[model samples]
Target: MAANWMRRTFVAAACASAALLTACGSSSVDSAISPDRFVVFGDGLADQGQLGTSFTVNDGSVNNWTSQLAARYDVKLTPASKGGWNYAYGNARISQSPDAAGNASTPTVVKQIDTFLAANKFADNDMVVISAGVSDVIANTMAFINGTITQDQLMANATQAGADLAAQVTRVINAGAKHVVVTGTFDLGRTPWAKQIDKEQLLTQVMLALNNRLKIDINPLGGKQVLYIDAAYQVNLFQGNPGAYGFQNSDTAICTSVDAGAGIGTGNNRVNSALCTPNTLLPNADPIRYVFSDNVYLTPEANRRLGEYARDIIVLQW
Candidate 1:
C-alpha cells in the first residue's frame, strides 16, 4: 500500500531529532488558497454533491442546518454542486481513503489531489477545504494507550500525521489554490470512547499538540489565503456548554446497538465502536443534547451546530 501522507508527513515534520520542529513547505506554484466569488465546474461537478446537503432524502435534508448555514451567507449552490441527492460520503478521511470500517471506496486525499492535478489546476476562486488527521490520530492514540507504543513515540507519529496533512495543503497551494480551509483535528480524548479519565486527558493533550504543531508549520508564511479551523477547541467548548447550543446530551451517544460491538477487532467499525443508528430513544433521552451519534461520529444535529461554530470562526478569520 502507498504510505499514507499522515505517516509520511511525520518523517518530514520531525526532520531534526533534538529540536523537533515542523517542516512545513508550501508548493512552488503561485496559486493562493483564498476565495473569490466565482463558480468552478469540474468533470465530477454533477456527482460531487453539495457541501451543506445531507445524504438522506427522507428527513427533508434540504432544510438541515448545513443548508441553513449556507443560506444565511447567500451561498447559492445548484443541484450539481450540492448534496448527492442520495447519500453523502461521511466515510471520507483527510489523508487516507475511506475509513477502515466504512462502506466507502473514495480515493484518499493524496490520490484525490493527484487526480485533480491530472485534470485541473486550482484557481483563485477554488477554496479547497481539507480535513483529516483525526481518524489516523484516533487509531494511533488508542494503540499507544493500549500499550502498543510509548507517549514520545506517539508524539513523533502524530507529528508526521500533522506534516502529511500540511504537505497536502501545501501541494494545493503550490498548484494555484487561492483559498483553503483546513479543519484541525478534534479532541478525540473527550469523545465518549475515552470513558476513562486520566488516560483521556493525556490523549486530548496529544491532539492539541498535533494541531498546534500544524498551525506552527502549515500556516502560510507571507500569504493570507489559508485559514485554519480550530476544530478541537470549538468541540471542547460545545462539550462544556451543551445547553448553550441547544443540546441536551453533551457527553454521551444517542445512537447505539447491542450487536454493534459483536466480534469487534481493532478497526473503527460499528461493532468495535458499539454504535447503533436507531432513531428510537428512551422517553428521557433527547438526541438534541447528545454530542455523538456513535463512539466517534457526530449526530446530524451536532454536525449542524459544529458547522455553525466553524462558520463563526471562518467569517471572523477568513
Candidate 2:
C-alpha cells in the first residue's frame, strides 16, 4: 500500500512539474529521467585539452569529429567543466592513478568519474562517451615481454581493468545515467613503436585479450541504456587499409618529437601531445594526414576519424 502511495505521489508530482512520464509500473526502474547533456571520460584519444594541451588540437580537433558527434545530439563537448557535463581529460587509465609514476599528473579514469559525480547526477537522456584501458594494457604487456613480470601477472591486470570498467558502469547507473557508451582501446600493438619490435603480435594478442575480457564483463550489463564500441575492430579497420582513411603511413611517427622509447625498451617516455604542434616537424608536414602524431597517440585526423566511427556506433545503439 505504501508503494502505491509513493507511485501515485511520484506520478502526481511529475505531471504537476511538466516532467515526462517516468514511472514504469515497478520499483525496479531507478530513474526514467533522460538528460540533455553529454558527459565524456577517458584518455588522450577522447580528450579535448581537459588535462592540458591536447594531441588533436594541432589538426583542429576542437572543430573536428567530436564537435560533429555532439552536434547530432545538439550539444558540443565542453572540457574543464564541473560534472564533466562535457569532455574530461588526457592520459586517463582504468587501473592507474593520474599520480602514478608516469602519468604526468593526470587523474585515473575512476577518479575522474568520482570527481564528476561528486558535483552532479545523470539522467536517461544524458549520453556518456568513454575509451580507456590502453595504458594498463601497455604497462602489463611491457612488463611481461621484458621478463619483468609474468604472463599470469598481465592476465591479472587485464582482469582488474574489466572489473574497474564494471565498477564505472555501476557508478554511472547509480548516478542516473541511462546511455553510457564505453569503448575499448584499439590494437595498441599495431602502433609505430610496437611494430618496431618482434613482440608486436604478442602485444596485440594481449591487448585484444584485455578488450575481450572487458567485453565479457560489460555485455551482460547492456540494456537500452548502455553501449560498448569494439575499438580494436574499428582501429584495425583503419590500420588494415590506411588509404581508405586518406593516410599513407600508420607505421611511422608523423612528428619528429615522437619518442622512440614510448612503451618500448625503456617504457618511461610519456606522450607529450603539447610538443606536437602542427608543422613542428618538416616545414611542410601535414599533421592531418598521418595516423600518429607521436609514438602511441593518434594524429588529429585519426582522432577525428575515430570520433566519426564513435558517432556511428552511438547511432546504431539508438
Candidate 3:
C-alpha cells in the first residue's frame, strides 16, 4: 500500500509539470509580438530634420509627420528623410550608390534607408513606413514649371517614380520587416508652392498614378501581412474641410516673421498669404509669409494632418 501511494503521487506531479509547460507554450504562441521599433522614410512631409536644414526659409520648427506619429503611438522612430527625396533615390541607395536626388535635387529616400539599416537591425515585429514620390513629380515637372521641360518628360518621370516607389517597398519587405505600410502621396497642388508651378492638376494626376502603381505592387503580398494606408484619402478629408478637423485657425500666412504674432491660423485654416509680398511689408520686422517658416513649407495644420495619418497607420486602434 505504501509503494502504491508513492507511485500515485509521482504520477500526479508529472502530470502537473506537463500541464504547466503546455500552458506556457500556448501563451507564447497566442501573444502577438509587440512592435517596439519603427523605421520611417520619405520626403519633407515625413522628414524629421534629416536634411539638417529646412528647405523653406523662416521655418524654425523641425517637426514632421513621422515625429508626431511616433509620439502618438509611443514607439521609437528612426527617421531617414530629406526634403525633396523620391523613390528612385531610395532604390539607388539599396542597389549601387548611396546618393540620389529626388525632385527637389535633395538626397534620396534610399540613402535614408541605408543609413537606418546600417545602424540598426530590424526584428520580425518591426514596422517601416514609406512616404515618397512627391519629389519625383516636383523634379520631373520642373521643366514644365520653367517652360524648359515638356509634358512628355513629366509623364515619363512620373511613371518612373511609381516604379521606383514600388521597388523601394519591395526592398523594405525583403529586408525582413514584419509589416510595411506604403502611404499614398498627398495633394501637392494645394500647397503654396503650387502657385509657383501652376500645375496642381497635373501634379495630382502624377501622384494618383504613382499611388495606383504602389497598389499593384502590394497586391502580391498577402493582405494580412503587408498593408497599404490610403493617406491620400485621409489627407483629402482634411483638405475638404479643415475646420471640421480642428485645424480651422492654424493658418500661417498671418504671421509675417518666424517669431511674429500667435502664428498664422488656428489649427485648420489654410495658410494663404498670397496677397502678402516678400521683403516689403510686415507688421513686424520679420517678412516671412505663408509657409511653415518662409513661403514654401507646410503649415502647422498640414503637419497635423500628416501626423494624424501616421497615427492611423502605426497605432492599432487610434
Alpha-carbon local distance difference test for all models: 0.50, 0.62, 0.50
Error of 2 at 181 (Å): 0.8
lDDT of 1 at 41: 19
Over 1-318, each residue of candidate 2 has an lDDT whose tens digit, in order, gives 997699558534533222111111112222333337777777666666664456443545453345555655557666754333544455567747632225556677787788777877776667887667766676676667778888878877777786787678767877787788887777877887687555677768777677777777776676476777666765665577777667777776676644444421225554445456665654566765677776667777666566555555454345
Q: What TM-score does candidate 2 reach? A: 0.78
Indicate the residue-level lDDT of 164 in model 2. Answer: 81
lDDT by residue for model 3 (1-318), tens:
997699558545543443333223211121133556667776545554443432223244324555555555466454344322222222122222222232233456666677666766667766567777655555555546666678877676666667677787788777877777677566655554454446668877777777777777777885455666665655555445555454442223333434222111211132322222343233553321122333334544455445654443334311
Model 3 bad stretches (over 4 Å): 1-33, 53-62, 78-106, 249-296, 313-318
Candidate 1 to truth, TM: 0.68
- TM-scores for all candidates? 0.68, 0.78, 0.64
Candidate 1: segments with Cα more than 4 A from true spot:
1-106, 145-147, 196-198, 257-284
Lowest summed lDDT over 10 consecutive residues: which window, candidate 2? 18-27
Q: Pick the candidate with the highest lDDT.
A: 2
